[model samples]
Target: MAAVRKSTNWFAIGVTAAVLVVVLIVAGVVWFANSQATSPGTLPESSAVNTETGAIAVGSGDKTVDTYIDFMCPVCNQFEQAYGPTLDQLVASDEITLNIHPISILDRASQGTEYSTRSASAAYCVAVDDAANVPAFVKALYAQQPSENTAGLDDATLASVAASVGASDAATSCISDGTYTRFVTAMTQNTPVQPGSGGIATPTIAVNGTVLSNQTDLTGDPQKDIVDRLNG
Candidate 1:
């Protein structure tokens, strides 16, 4: 009877150890999945794309102007509406090189559709297929920007938006497949931390590699502020 009791106890301990091992395996799998979800899966390949800086280069000016934007961010759309013309003028005049970084930090606002990531990825698709149409596509995206917590534009609508901007058939295919979503995630993670914020924010503008401050740099007139910064 004593031997049987000891054997039962050992069996119980083995079963508990087996359960723990299974639990540990599950935990590891969950961790891996989360990591991969956020990982920069692949870098975009294009003459207009700067993988090192994670920006879609538009102009070949001397001074660099980088705008980190999330498509789902309302503030970003507002920024575009306010300064899109100024930036376009600057680019056209070759005053500043516009590096548009299509990032995804507002995925939480997209009701699980991950609109921010999808749109940004679609931008990359356009960049890949037709780099020149990128600016138009960006403007069109903000023109039809969806409200927060909504599912946002479906894949087909995104494709149509691209097509409206003259993006090619391959660009539409890329948008539908979400080829650069992981790339957008990686860029969002690496988004430059602005001064005083201590966190990532959309429409974060950097002039000549210096992050601008809303208080000191942008004093009510963003257009003048950016122009002055470029000329400064």
Candidate 2:
């Protein structure tokens, strides 16, 4: 009887161990699934007419011009102030498709406010809420860009800027709530591996999928240079 009891006890112990292992495995799978479900996928209500690869795009021309910029970069601000009008004109005339990629390379420069991310996320909000006004909203944001090391614009200021560009209350709410912050974070992380755009820096310009290495003169007329490049 003692021998039989010992054998039965061993079997019970083995069964209990097996059940515990299965429970652990099931718990791990559930946690992984939940994490994946919470991860950000793509921008909400993204439209191809004004967005591609997480960029705010305008125009439907044959030639493509991709502009990567960080709002906190002074040099990027200069580039925008110099070439913004020209780019807008080209897009308006359908001479070239203009795709503006708002990235968050300078998040650290905002003194812990993560201004670059906030601004980029706000831009995404504008894109989702008011796609047609994206260009205007971008120009306005650059116009009021704060210097690095500052706290950057607060949420109210950002919302006001959006309102100035005819963005509705929905856009303001979206910006305030940071609805697309996770999406912006994901886009920034994937910038290097972006299809047809490998390892880019701020103010990076690409014409027809060809990235430019040399900096074009900010003072010189970019219209002619852009036209030549497109024609070339």
Best by lDDT: 1
Off by over 4 Å in 1: 1-38
Query: How well is each residue in 131-157 modelled by candidate 1, as lDDT tens digits?
Result: 899999999999999999999999999
Q: What CA RMSD would you report for each candidate?
A: 4.6, 4.3
Candidate 1, residue 77: how far the Cα is off, in Å = 1.2
- TM-score (C-alpha) between model 2 and the true structure: 0.80
lDDT of 2 by residue, 1-232 (tens): 5665433588888999999999999999999998766566445686742323666777888888888778888878887877778888888899888987778888898989989988888888787877788888888988898999999999999999989998899988888888777766666654543334455567777778766653442335685656677888
* Weakest 10 consecutive residues of candidate 1 by summed lDDT: 1-10
Please report the candidate that would top TM-score against the real structure. Answer: 1
Clashing residue pairs in candidate 1 (N, C-alpha, C atoms within 3 angstroms)? none
